[model samples]
Target: MLSPNTTLKQIEILGYLGTKFPNWIGDDSFNNIVDIKLSGSQHCSNLPPLGQLPSLKILHISSFDSVTTVGAEFYGNSSAKKKPFSSLEILIFKNCHYFEALSMSDGQCQELTYLSIYCCRSFVSFPNGGLIAPKLSDLNIYNCPELMWLPEKMTSLSSLKSLTIRSCPLIKAIPEGGLPISLSKLRINYHQLLRIKWNWQTLPNLKNTLSEEGFPTSLSSLSISGCPLLKKIYDTKDSENKEYWRKISHIPHVGGSSERQEEDSFLNMKQAMF
Candidate 1:
């Protein structure tokens, strides 16, 4: 038995285990912990009691093969009288194939800044209203091929700065006028996307009316890559639409001779069609 005086600040447990984890872990082993990582545990089916770690700032769990369900009270039961990590800043779950949904008993995380879920094949979407962190600034979702779209309530991320989605082959469209005005960098790669249609009027028109007033630019970089099905990116006005085409055409291509020729042919076709 471990002593109660043992205040472990960080713990990483890996490799296969055949026995039930000591329930004492939930009772006494995590009081001072600020970070925890569990990976490659073959027999583990559930998490160590987590809400007990009031100071936990980062949590990463991966490769626990036998776990299939993530319960709404996984953090803590009402009987335990524990709460979510008020100081939690980052959470990452990687390669835990059977884990499906995330449920937060409360509706928010006031301090969480980053959340990343990678290669979790069974997850269908971000959790509903009770699952988001209020101060979340960066979100990355990758290789979850079954996910078709982001949650419709994403605009509630008022402080979001970076959003990246890669290799989700089912996503078909960006929610119309749904991007947060505070977004600074946006990247979408290899999604099964067919078109990007934005209503320019719905977006903040900082440049046109404030050309002389010089309002600070909020959005700086936008990139879309490896989307073979994408055919168009358009604007609300015909004149601005022409400018959009010019911008897309000018984006450089990195390729050998055949690829360059193919790009040239596409450009010629675009010019002819326009």
Candidate 2:
């Protein structure tokens, strides 16, 4: 148990294993803690219920070798009365090999703004039900090979601004509803599942001023690269996928290899056909 007298604004636990933080930290004793960083916890199979800390704003957890399957326990005691991570703004998870599954109760992380997940190869499941991060502005997912879908109800995040998906080879498609119109910059790179024919036919019905539900008209910048199959569709010989083509044509920045994109019929032949 941590001393009832203990009080700190920052905590760091590095290169340690079998470490257990005292539950007493959450009993109104450590409300001032703002930053917690844990790295190289190679043999640590479990984590403290730090979510109960009301003032926790930044959390970075990485390199837990023996840990697998994260569930509500990491959030807080199942019977605890308080909301978890209520004041958190930035949450990051990386380099945890065996960690899989993140199931959190609703109304948590209510003030969150930036969420990132990277290098977690074994991670498969995210919070169940639907994700409700109202203030989330930047959501980045990278190097996660098995995550095939984002939350089903992402449109609830009306404040989202920038989204980046990278190095996740198995993610076959974006969420079914497409992205929130609030998004201004979107980037997809080094993805394998997106490589093959992007089944635009399977895209969710997204709304805009011109259509019922198409791509978000508010999007200003778009980028796509390393998706072989999508590129094939872009450079096909006799093009008829205008609906798909028109969707990204207006976006200002769809970054990729200039040489290949210049040869693309989608871009070069637009004038010839018009």
Candidate 3:
């Protein structure tokens, strides 16, 4: 048992084999804790109610193989008036093979600025009504092969600035109603099936747009790979590709296969002449 006078502010437990935590884990004495990370705890079927910790600002959950859903239990049902995750600013879920859905109860994530879901292959989508994070600035989803959609009405996240989706092949488009104009940087890589049919009408403020790996260079706005059809539209000179070019014409950078070819051509010309 932790001492009542304990002022511990951070806790990290990794590779724990316990099926459940001691009841004291949810005690109010942990209210001062600001960060918690539980990783590689393969036997734990459920997570401790770390949300009850009033000062918690960051949480990272990884490789919890048995946990399938994060539901009301995560918010601590001890009281109706409690506001869980009220101060959380960053949350990450990684390599949870069985994690399928995330459902919140009385939690408030308005202060959450960074959220990431990585390598959770079984994660399908958020629960209905979706996560509500009004202040989220950066969201990254990587290698979540089964993810079907982004959070509902993501346009409501007016403060969102960066969104990166990599290797989430199932996500066909952005969330309904399109992304907020506040978004400045967007990256979607290895989405072979993404149809590029999103509403580009509201993205006048988007400073940086889609690319494969790194930030598009000063001359690049969009870089695509594993998208042959888009490449065709870009390479061919015809009337049919006009709309396709128009969709991305507003972006003001350049880095992609075309740039690579230009570099190769320059090298070849130098070698042939010299």
Clashes of each: 0, 4, 7
**lDDT (tens digit, per residue) of candidate 2 on 111-162:** 8899888888888877776567889999988778877777667767788877
lDDT string, candidate 3, 1-274, tens digits: 5343348888888898889977767566687888889899888889887766778899999999999998877777556466778799999999999999988532466688999988998999785776688888999888889987888887777888888777788888777788888877776764542465654447655534443322322213344445545445544345565565445444454333334785354334323322
lDDT of 2: 0.68
Clashes of 2: 4
Q: Which stretches of candidate 2 lie over 4 Å from their true place?
A: 1-5, 22-27, 190-274
In the range 1-274, model 1's lDDT, one tens digit per residue, is 5434448888777884854565555453456878878788778787665655677888888987777666643565455444556678898889988777766545335688998888988777666653466688898887788777676566677778788777777777766447665565555663332344433333352112222213213334334456444334342234545665554443332111123465455555445536
**lDDT (Cα) of model 1:** 0.62
For candidate 3, report its TM-score.
0.75
User: Best by lDDT, which number?
Assistant: 3
List runs of model 1 lying over 4 Å from the truth: 2-5, 80-82, 175-177, 190-196, 199-219, 227-274
Give the per-residue Cα lDDT of candidate 3 at 141. Answer: 86
- lDDT of residue 66 for candidate 1: 73
Best candidate, TM-score: 3
